[model samples]
Target: MNDHITTPITPDLLRGALELERTEHGLAPHRLPVRARAQGDGQLAMAEAQPSGVRVVFRTRAGVVELDTLRTRVGYRGMPLRPDGVYDLLVDGELVAQASTTGGKVLLLDMATGTAETRPGPVGTVRFDGLADRVKDVEIWLPHTEITELVALRTDAPVEAVPAGERRVWLHHGSSISHGSNAASPSTTWAALAAARGGVDLVNLGFGGSAMLDPFTARAMRDTPADLISVKIGINLVNADVMRLRAFGPAVHGFLDTIRDGHPTTPLLVVSPILCPIHEDTPGPGAVDMEDGSMRFRATGDPAERAAGKLTLTVIRTELARIVAQRSVDDPNLTYLDGLDLYGDADHADLPLPDRLHPDAATHRRIAERFAEAVFSPEGAFAPQPVTA
Candidate 1:
């Protein structure tokens, strides 16, 4: 007789998502809650649904596990089809296996016209067998760059949700770089790697082109329960050319103020953008360089615009340092980290950004190492505080 058990995907078995949307095929994890999604654009929609740090967590003695999923893959019309998203399986906190689905829905975009088309496909199954039979922790990390709908999970033995034992929860918000851009897999993203090193549960809200200090996003961050919080700012603002320097400061202030409304004493760190040579002194309205039929980015805004309060990486960094310094006077838990400290000129020279924008896989690992050492170490900003009488 067959003894396999099939389990339905539920919130109890999932981590990192603020909300889950029920879909025809299965449940879709979302980094942002419904209210925040309602206020966002298409970019935010795609990014949030990618499930950067989201994963399925459970404990079981089964050696055989099967997961059914429907993945939504993104593609560009002229560019070669992107590779299928990767799903990583970790047993007892160690990466055990990696797999990719064969076919699923595909969303093709026309970059020049800003139009997109979606083609339907069927669900795919990812199976992992030959794991040790002893009871162990299991984490099935979803694809960080694809929209995944969880269908069902099958195991040779019963599975139970893992309890949130002693791990501190880390809530991070930023741009695409933090959204696992160019990272090898879900567990390899800089934020994920850093969270692993810190021994914290991660919640990543790194929208691709939509980290524009949206009020609703700040409110979402305010309402979320977290032991540690961080916001990586500057890049998206500059690339999108959404605001001037005059507006950027107040927007950042308001974002932090909103988060403080809920967790006034939580260790909150604000990080500026990492080094981007093209946008260092040049203002953005960054443009795609498609003349050679390859993806590259160049800043289009005039460097002279800085005199008119236009935002650049250098200017933003200075302003962020000033704001954090002034605010740290009243809020001791508030800390500022220069993005360059994570990925700076010297490091960039060694590992240049693949597209003059996002970091490649190796750079992601480097950034994660720097972040873990600087922010997760005992002396770091988010380090555990000693209790006093």
Candidate 2:
């Protein structure tokens, strides 16, 4: 192997991705393309395009692989520092190394003042030294929770993009629950875990604080190539109180319609949100209460609001079941898995959502396991097809 060889970080070397757009630093992998981005709020756009489940896949005989990246870290004033995002390295499909950037810019926020500031930090390089001497496939999974810009790549040997996974691509979209919120690592996100067990390539479009049934997101899904698809809806909508029930059904139909436009026969799974005690019956617009010097979420909407078409997790589940059942009459590929099946009140009673909303890492594991068993079984709607020799 050569002592040094710099490879431009280009789009061709990545997989489980939708689009790669040039950022000021280098390439920013995006789940949503320009068209979808142009139509979303700055928050939604940023979250949706943050490269969850995106990774760089290449083949080489390199002994050392170094990746330079600029990560934008989020911080809250007076709170415990958030850990650096992890970059997982897999060789021949087995995880061999895990890394994190040493330094990057930080976005600081003061929840009390409603003010935010940026602290400039330097770009950092992550090096994974010592690999097998023979040529092999390598995949560097980017940090799922950080906003990262791929600046450059260096290896000891010549490299080329590896072939895409032989397994079908599974495209899934949801809110923070699916975005790896509080996940142990990018590859440990529930969807990631399920994808691994289900033996499918994952394209995670789980946008934290987003996933509001946006037309652009649906359109993006409609245009993307995929063999199987799923959308985990409800949590973000209810928490954000983005829409009333009167508008939700039509919005859902519209979103599914857009996906059907392109994936006329692809098996589509519509997942409702996992059980959150706070939002189970209480209509949302969830509020973060820091009045007691603790950051905890509280259900702000009154249960009475449901009388006027407001949304709650229970309401969403019922509606989603109805919608999927009605459509399955003609579209047999459509399936609905009650989010409760993956996680319900009983599970939560034992697991307990630490934040009263998002699932902890252990809970993420439970959800992933349930999802794999329920959806990837031979009788399941998204059962894996046997590979032909």
Candidate 3:
């Protein structure tokens, strides 16, 4: 006879064990958190999931709420949460959902009623349903004033996965115009529309009131991953009057250099500002009239200053082209696209920008179409290499 020994399991030993296991027989959904800028407000919708046979346990600063059955056919929208504190969700006590609203917006969900709301002030809560199993805890993350938390979460189930293969990634950075400023939907943003037209993934780094040649943003772009990249500059800088020509040249160089550090020979495109009559040749103390959509210009620099061929859009665009040409001599993959190429005098003449500034939705579509044609067409400006067997 052989003696058998049995090992005893203790709660402490299993306490650290990951108990949540997603299997074909059961379901566990992934949850995403929303983030909003300080004094900024917005909403976030959840990624559609297998609504049938799932339950959601949502947690917010307000408290925890359990949602009933979710509708599989229709995608669910999340409740609104403000940027008061960290927000999070847990399934079986394993942290699977998290988000922060430092200075931006955060959206949570309540699937039962199919209603979504934005959180007021700096903190809020939301809940969802269709969790296949039990949940243990929820969590939230609030880092700082500069972070905007917007996330898309889903429960694990039999959902169609994004096709895998050689995927095309579009990396873009620009000013508020590219940041979905007045666009009706996120997908309607010119950059987003362009990405869809080209069938490429997008990494949008468009920042409102913050595209003033920050080295940190350049560093961020340099470190990020992408198959194609473009930077929309000049408009914000000109409007802000943050730098003169003396500083602008070096800044452009530095910004591109930073991105080149990582992208190296990637298809990088630099874009100048669109046509703005007020700021085209005139120096700004730019003012916007919401009532009449007319812009009033205050002279920030002497007309003689610009008369010397400095601090004008023409000068900036020329300098940008020069720098890119010089750099492209060594890095053939780099390129530059004039903003006017997308929405020049003719296009603008027809679809004049509503406020004498930002393009309206129709103009956005035109710009998107032009960009797609230029960047994605077979003979487009930034076409991919022909694959060789």
For TM-score, the strongest prediction is: 1
Give lDDT for model 2.
Answer: 0.88
43-132 per-residue lDDT for model 2 (tens digits): 776586567899988999999999999888877798865788899999988889998888888878787887778788788998898899
For model 3, the stretches where C-alpha displacement exceeds 4 angstroms are: 1-166, 292-302, 307-310, 385-389
Candidate 3 lDDT over 80-100, as tens digits, reads 322232233444334454433
Clashes of 3: 45
- Extract clashing residue pairs from model 1: none
* Per-residue lDDT of model 1, residues 1-389, tens digit only: 15889988889899999999999888999998898899989988998999999999999999999999999999999987778899999998899999998678999999889999999999999989999989999999999989999998999999999987458999999999999889999999999999998889999998888789999999999999999999999998898899998898999899999999999999999999999999999998999887565689999999999999999999999999999999999999999999999999999999999899999999999999999999988899988556689
TM-score of model 3 (CA atoms): 0.61
Clashes of 2: 0
TM-score of each: 0.97, 0.95, 0.61
Highest-lDDT candidate: 1
Residue 299 deviation, candidate 1, in Å? 0.6
